[model samples]
Target: MRRMPTRAKVEMAAYGASAAALAVVPSMEVLPAHAAAAAISGGSLWWLYRKAKTGDFARTIRSAQRLLGPVTGGVVYAAAAAAPGRPWWEIAVALGWGGVMAAWLPVTRSTWTPPAETGGPGYPPGFTGLVMRLWDDAEVAPGTWLEDIEQTVSPEHPDFTADVVALAGKPVPRLSDVDIAAAFGVPTACVTLADKPGHGPGRLRLTVAPTRRRGGGIEEVWAEVVARPGGAIPGSKIVHVKTFPAQGDLPARGMVLAEVEPGEVARINHEQLCSAFGVKAEELRLVAQSRGREALVTLYESAPLKGARRATRELLTLDAYGRYTIGTAHDGTDAKVHMQSAAGTFHGFLVGVTGSGKTVALALMCAAWALAGLANWVTSARPDAQMTAVGRHVDRQGAGAIFTWWMLKAAIALMDIRGRINGEVGHDFSGHSPYPGLVLVLDEFNSLVGDEALGDEIAQMTDVLAREGRKFGIGIVFAGQSLNLSKLGGEASLRDQVQGGIGVVLRIASASGGIAARQATGGLAGDVDIAEIPDRFNASMSLMDRMHGTVDDVPGETTQGVGHTVTGSEAVMMRTLYVHLPKDGSPDGLGEIFPEGGGINTLTEREIQELTELGLWHDWTMPPPSAGGDSGDAMPAFTGVEAGGGIGTLAPPPVAVKAKKATVKEQVLAVVDREMTAKEIRGLVDAAAGTVRNALSDLVTDGKLRQVDHGVYAPVHAPADV
Candidate 1:
């Protein structure tokens, strides 16, 4: 026989395997007669399998069997094969066997298998459900242990202890003291159990009481459980449970007390109070409640009699309390000063190290007083007197005039007080009107008058103010790095004059003397050593009364005279005047007294003409007439004469003609420098191109620079110099 083809051999092998599979399947077992329908149904499945293996329709039939499975699928396959059937029963039997095989096929044998009896990796069945289901499971029984557990546990069960325990292993011990305690979410000492009242089997009563642990009381509850004899298992009943918070427990309270009374109390926590007042914490004493109350009361009630208005203004107006109307200006004109004082008198000394804002405080006080409609009279002997003479003069001329005469006089007098009077004495205006009543802010008072030479004068001034200023409404504010009563000649007298003292001790050389002593014992009567003053303008001022232990708003009365308060506006004006005053011609100096920025040499030709017309200039002359037969034999000659002079004196030369040349040059340069380019120089000069170029080149060559880049020329030198 010829060797069979590989395809034919494969087909024969497949058919033989199918036939063997069919034969083996039916012989295994058969459904009973009652299961005959099932058996027949299973036979149809075998037929379909044969169809799937033998025909092109095999994959579809197998897929249909897979989707429809077993019984229902066998019926469909049997019907399809029997449409032209040779034997329906045989087809039925074959289809039934196929259906049975399909139904029992292990499709997932490679990928998955049934878990072992011990179960899979996750929690055993009913673990969560077992916890929930155990109550229903017959082994544990419902309502059996619930009551017993409820006895030791809470009906409103705490989350941590709601657990199930199997009683099969051993006798169920009554919930442990720890477990019972945990069930109530408290400590073990808080829980206890008692046998049931009737001593029934497995019955108990539990009481959970609060425990005093960690110094805090705990709430507690009580419950009872009685076990009843049952058919399956002993059942439990919750008799009673009660919950209540611990009694006799009070909330914790702060230990601080309202020890100090409201009136005249000195707060011990003065640093805290000062903080509230927005001042340096170290500037005040820390007192206990009683002392703090006393101190606070003293401060609240204290007032300076002489500087009452000033004190009120500072405390009320400038302070955190008073809401006084702040006037924009004196009757709506230019704002002159910041009026802060209600009564208009101020008396205090400002003490701070150099650059510690002492000067600024004085200025602020003066301004406040001036705004209050009181004149501030600052008298400083220091060469830098700008801060002291703010509103003393109006314009530069007025400032110059005052500094030339009046300032000089005041300086000379001050020098005389220090025994340094060098020249002849000038006019004394001690008895003048508008006696500047506001504070006489004297800066660097120690330096103004040498210690030895002017001690007496300083003492005398202090005495005068101490003894008589209140009567005259004159206030004094002495400022310095160091202020000593001895420097003023007498401690008692000096202290008497300065009832209201402010000390801003940036760094104290010795706390025992000077402002330290006065500030320590003055109004505040405290040992406050200001190590440094802050940069804020009035930061140190608020501590004045506290450091001195003085009462707020209580002005100290001095026998001197009525104290004058300085307003903010006047202080600003004085500062402006001081700043504007030329250094050399300042009132405290003996420099040239010419008007500021308008000296003799700076006088314009027109000004000179005006002066000459007014007969003010000493040297002014005119040119002679041109010789044109009108004054035959006339000779140009000089004659020293004055204009508008008496008979025998020749009429003075015309100043206009004498100043004409300088005047014309000045006017030309003025116009050219303003808007002239190099190209436009000739038009403005009204001269030939060569002449204009020469003048322009000359101006540039002389160091009167111009904008070369823009081709615009301006005078590099001072206009007045030009």
Candidate 2:
């Protein structure tokens, strides 16, 4: 025979004693009736005490009911045996005893008890059990009473029914998981509850205890009870279960994890995390650590550009986890952008300082994204046409045309030198399909976007992107020297919109603190220091791959390695010259001036002079013509003839001169050209007062001209030069 446990043995002994006391009660009831009745009552009292000790109230009630039936029958029989003389009194006494026995039996069976209705003091079924289990298992110590309770009554227990109604009569507090997690010493990984359903009755709460460490310190343990979907447990089953802190031990920095409802993960991945939060994989660590399991995840999947494998490799090598990548090369000669579906995507803050090679890197990435058909480039700068010659193959017709045309129009629109907006600025791009993946790359982004009015517009635009862009495949890339929460409209909005950021510190007095610094250094202080960055060194080469949860330190030298640098003037000249000249002089004007065909060259003297004379070249003038040779040789000269005069008129004058040398009045007559303005002719002719008056009168009389003003005059006939 096996030995029973101590508690079980005690219960058995109590049961045996209760049974023996009840057995003799009926037999003794007939002798000395009053004494017998007292004895029987005493025995019943003893049995009741024993039953209570055994904690078997249900069994005790059943035994009492069985004993009542026989006792009542015996009472009736006794009344008959003792009723020979005084029959009426005897009958009444016997009837009263029988009724008393009947009443007592029912009372014993029906009295209320705690154990049958509820699960004693420990467990309650339905809502009560669910709430209790949530509380009890919340932060159990390794060997504590609560741990034992957890083992006995859990959500998976045989009698476990998650009806929250048990907590209906109890007072419970309402709190978010995050708050509960904070109150407790545990990492956020353990909270698994959801918000309460609209009509649900119970509150969700979490409890945590610090985990004991080997060094005598303690880490936190966590637990929580959340409103689950569906009805109560045992009846309702959990469709999907997720555990957070995907990576168990948190790094020195921190960690973040998320759980998604069955089919809901995809939406969260695309819109909330990727487009709204702009979270790259690397950035997830910080978010996880800070926000914990309750943090919402919204991110999207992205790919590298097609045909840009080399450029992608180079970019990855430089900034391994950076959000940006170099796409298809313009000329198909250098690194061609290859779109890889595995590249992933993010939305977040971006930082690029001066001399950080950010411009080139950005251009390269934009080109790649555009080429891969993943993003449409919306910028106020033209795609450098020279890119076509750089060994990167490009399609002039496909999406490339959209990029080229839009960029060209933007460049023309922003030009300040022409003093007037050009017609090219109005060129229509509405014909092209509205780009679903539109990414506005604002270079020197702060200049236009930082203004109060423009900032508001940008903020609104960002809001739209954060809220609705994912649906339309629209995104934004903002690059600048500094990014602060205020500059981005607000900290919360910026945090939500920008999931990934790249910081390139090319020597600045100060940098945005916290996350900004981490962005530059890849979360490693030694890897970069924005304030101490060397003149030519860019500390922001580290790629904050928020999508991958990594930081790729791409040295400045490496990312900028294959790119060329041209001064502003040089670039301008190259563009202008190459478009007019050719290498072999077949006379595609764009090719000749730029033999290397980059379209940059110096203008010749003759061309300069011609342009100057036309009023087209204002910034420069023609060089002096060379000495000696015939300067006017290139012009056609005029040849002419003269008419013979006066010889025919001389004969009549000789004789007449001798006869009359008579005195003549000899009045000086001054002819004034009155039609012309006096101011105009004042410096051309001289006259005395009276003499000029007579000449004017004579000229007027002769109908030569007339005065238009007091001193003005008009010509009677057409002038020499009109």
Candidate 3:
């Protein structure tokens, strides 16, 4: 009774419990044996679990030696019990030999060994041997998983590693600790599961012990698992041993300190870290607090981003901080992305050519933000029917009937004043703005940039906003066709900062998309693979949606809007949510009132009435064609007409066969055979408001037309004589 040690007590319990189990297994007769066998197995598991909790072992051998005694000895004891007529001395000798072999094996020079085990928590029987023999380059075979498996573009990793480690009945292992399991006899366990969600299971790993060799390890062994007969590989983890510098760059904690030589810190920068680890830099996590002065870089591999969905209302919940999910990453992760969701107002530039669905994408993004309760404003310096539709649901839809440059100029001016007000209030301004989450959407940004005078003012506004307004919760959405960061109105600092700022940039397919990608993302456009996006949205809309409706008659494909999303230095493939264009036909009688259909209607009935009250209506009207009886039969107004003109009822000269009308683009390109004012082109083509300007810009951009001076455009292939 003199204070038996805890280790001795555990050993006694294990020996007594295992012996009882063998004694019952041979009795095989009936209920008593069954009860006894179950008790032995359950009791052994409970006892081992408690013993594991009792003490920690630095090496696997120490712990395995303990379990090795019980497990291997139990097998021998069972064999002896099963031998019907074996002599008592023979049985004793067999048990004693097994114990002696177990005790002496560790002292012999050998490799990581496995201990025989029945079963324990989290780990199955034979798990140690399985991991020891087959932990590397193993995959979960197809049939082992559920049959109704949701096969994705990528496979999934299993979550079985933690359980295996837990079942190993050892204390959790540290990075430097040889802690794979006490039974596997090795000190490491690493499992790389399926990157795709619903990942299947597999274990991959290799242990490397470094020696004096430079850039070469001393000894390396592959921990490959062999599948059971007719069984699939059970993947639980990937394992590898990391080598760290022995000195200061020496790894104290889990991280290996990359060399911090002069300028070497930056030279071994984020990309270098990713390259060293062989993964996307975004997958790596930098340790914030390292024990040593040297920084330790940590790489964390989570589920790869994937299974992007369409725009949903749930994704529209953004805080005043301007955080919003425009869409998900193509890699199938749970990460939500916000454009320029920083502390204050910054700029996000979106570039895509016409038919690239850029406008629709921008519109939907803005709508998502607005629905999220973020105070968003819009401005289109180059106002058009499409842009008008995009902004219809937002704050810039004619508050006080304001539109175009009025809104654009006012937004910029307000940002300046707000910046001033913010300085008076405080720089951070209590976490957000007075009107928090103010997103000024600059639609058709290149038009503003195209203006020699307004471009400078806009650039000046951008510099200030991108500088101070972001602190005041003022963010800007810069959208245009083929927007180039370097060509953003000669502001080098502005371009540099924005290109490197905290906003998501989307580069869709375009003529100048490559330029924007190179300038803004500093990456190749070829990587985007726009062609992969199928033309999936060709289905017809309702007749109403096609005619008087503002919805796109030819709806954009779900995949067509796919682009490259650039968040700082990293770029990932992304697909913007499909935009359901709103129906925004002009109100009935609106065209009649406008007459010219460009600016506000000069001949509105209200205006006409007011003019009549002021006696100006009479002046504007033509005196009702002179009600004085047309002054003697209207002075024979048709005198020059031939007598045959009177026979208009005679088939109207075969109805003067009409020709099919051509598109505004065709007309513009043909007429640009000679120099002409935009006004002349408008009169000739009679296009809609903003249509001529868009066409002109397109013609210029496409090398179809050259602007000789303001408003005058001549065909690029026009004859010199003309």
- Best candidate (score: TM-score): 3
Superior by lDDT: candidate 1 or candidate 2:
1
How well does candidate 3 score on lDDT at residue 533? Answer: 22
**Residue by residue across 430-490, what tens digits does model 1's lDDT show?**
2232233334555555554443333344444554454444434445566666564444445
Candidate that scores best on lDDT:
3
Candidate 3, superposed: residue stretches over 4 Å from native: 1-308, 319-322, 339-343, 381-386, 397-404, 415-433, 452-454, 485-492, 496-516, 520-558, 582-722
lDDT of each: 0.35, 0.32, 0.43
For residues 1-722, could you state the per-residue lDDT of candidate 3 as single tens digits?
A: 13434544455555555554454455345566555545654565566676677666444445455455545654555565556754565445554554465335443233333334424223323323344233221322211211111111111211122221211223322223232223223323321211223332232222222211121121111112211121111111112223221222212122333222233221113333333333443321222111122333333233112123555555545545555555554433323445453433345667665555666666666655555445566666544566566544555442111133233333444443455556766755343435445667766666665554235445555545555555556666677654544444445555554554333344334323224355433232212212112223223344565588666655533444555555544444455654454336443221211112222212224323532442323321121121123236431211222344421111111111123478778878877668788888888776884998898988899888888788888878665556
* Model 2 lDDT on a 0 to 1 scale: 0.32
Candidate 2 stretches with Cα past 4 Å from truth are: 1-348, 380-436, 452-455, 484-490, 500-532, 536-722
What is the total number of backbone clashes in candidate 2? Answer: 85
Q: What lDDT tens digits, residue by residue, belong to model 2 across residues 622-693?
A: 211122235453222111111222111111111111122321112211223234544444344464554445
By TM-score, the candidates rank as 3, 1, 2
Per-model root-mean-square deviation over C-alphas: 30.8, 35.2, 23.8
* Off by more than 4 A, model 1: 1-345, 385-436, 451-455, 500-722
